[model samples]
Target: MARASATPRSSAYLSALSQEIEKKLQRALASPPQRRNLLQELFADVALEVDDRARDIILSREEDTISPADDSHLGQLCFYDVLADYYVQAPESGKPILDLIVQLWSQSFASHIFSLLFHKWLFEVQLDNPEVLLRYSSALAQGATNVFWIDIQTNTRRFQSLFCYLLDEVAVEPARLNKIPVQAQRDLYLLLSRFILFYNSGDKLDTFLKHCPTFPNAFLIGGPTDFFVTELADQLQKLKVEPVLLHYLSNLKVLQGMELRMATSTRLKTCLYSFTSPGGPMYPTRAVRHAAWDALDLLFPLFDWRSRTLHPVYSAHLQRRSTA
Candidate 1:
């Protein structure tokens, strides 16, 4: 008699189950709202099954010892694709489904799932569609923040990579930075600033600051506020990433009538002075001081002092005096 086939019957069974699930999802999307409930139940069932397998695999081996090739043993790779596709198809419903699986799986397992979902969302989708990109990015930012904040130490690299990726994207297409909704922008930028202060170091930190844009709107709401600007200044000074700070400060513009504009200007001015103060490290460094001076000189003209009685000529005179 012929020997048993080399294929694992277990793998075959899982593959068939995945296909059936996909068919059920397609049907669910097409069917009435009541029928969709069955699809939701099926989704929960799949999450439970995958969660069990992932836990067993995680417990059987050490974290770093497990290789990508080992994902097959846990049926993780297949499920990763399936869940991501489900989310892409039905984002509203699929978000909760994805959340359930993440809560049910081990950290490593959840990370792998998130990685796949993020990859699909970032690389596969066309960024030209601003609305679609915003929705997806908001979802991704929220999901990653929720999952990783619990164990930030373990997820440091992921957060760092995300920060760098968004920075690069904005660096390339500066307009995209402001187009994102203020709330989403705050969420992403807050995460990035946290990464910069805690997770990043040396060359990576410098590079991030250097590429940081000068867009006025980028700094208005969700971008760097007064607190972050002050905090980032201290971090950069400690890291001796002063030149990068120069690039950052060079772009600082206090537009007229913006909310908190006066407070922002005051904070920025304090930060600039700190760079060139008597005991500051950059006080003796000509390049850093000059860069800081140039930035300050540029910013001095934009201060809306909001004086009701001061003449325009006096304001102009003061502006000219400061530059002189």
Candidate 2:
């Protein structure tokens, strides 16, 4: 059986489906059912297809993706390609998506682990093919590390949700449960932590701070305003990942969709940025980031359901910053 593999041709199919999904997402969100039945169905369809029979699947959810069928009903929606197009067509559709993302974040840590699992799968698949993997890895990071606010305006939900859910979930849980190799986990964590900043979870931050050994994955740690970079810095030091943080002294643009130059600082253009070691992870340079970001943007709301557990982000500028 030829499952959906990551080929240009198969991508063409997903690319088309994504467009329709974007259009439908608007209708679905504006008039969402009071119950979660229909949206949940879409989630199930995408999840099953991606998991059960996706061979040419350009991208899969993280290793620890949560299925809706999980014992606790804590399913994960980590496929950004499924939701990116929805974001492109209907930026306003993000409300429900955001609700779903927060729900995943707040409700089930196990479901979120799927994100990690998917990461392991993607990177591991690339290990034998060094040339292709490096580029794909970057695209994965850009979309994976994407924040919800960016998705509200652009089409990066599928990738963003997977990264955020995995990083946060892993950080919050006991490290003993992770069977993934240390080097691989550090590499993925570095990319995942870059644009992700979780608030109101005091000890969770503490836990992430504790596990970073040599600090190879510092790219994942950052200090965003409205929250506080210094606090993030302090936490990074406590967790022994300060070396990695220091390596990431300057922020690169990680958000893929932006005006380049917004009207004001408030509208500064942004792009997703990720680090790549030469001769390193999947899609080492361009392919991963480009393909994944494009696909994630292509699918948006449907694939990238926003978190239900997370509340609104109030933008209060402390000092100006940019991901560009």
Say which candidate scores most in lDDT: 1
**lDDT at 302, model 1:** 34
Tens digit per residue, CA lDDT, model 1, 1-324: 011121233334434554665455455445555444644455345433245564344224333333222323223333443344334433553444344434434323333334434434444333567675565556656555543343243332333333444545542344555555555555555545533434333234434444444445554533334434545545445434444444444444422222344655576566665554345454525565556656655655434458545433234344443433
lDDT of 1 at 218: 51
TM-score of decoy 2? 0.29
Off by over 4 Å in 2: 1-120, 123-126, 146-161, 168-196, 199-202, 213-324
10 residues in a row with least lDDT, candidate 1: 1-10
RMSD of 2: 21.6
lDDT of 2 by residue, 131-240 (tens): 33443344334334333223323432333434434556443344421434444455554543443442222324445545553443234432222122323333332221
Q: At residue 81, what lDDT does model 1 achieve?
A: 37
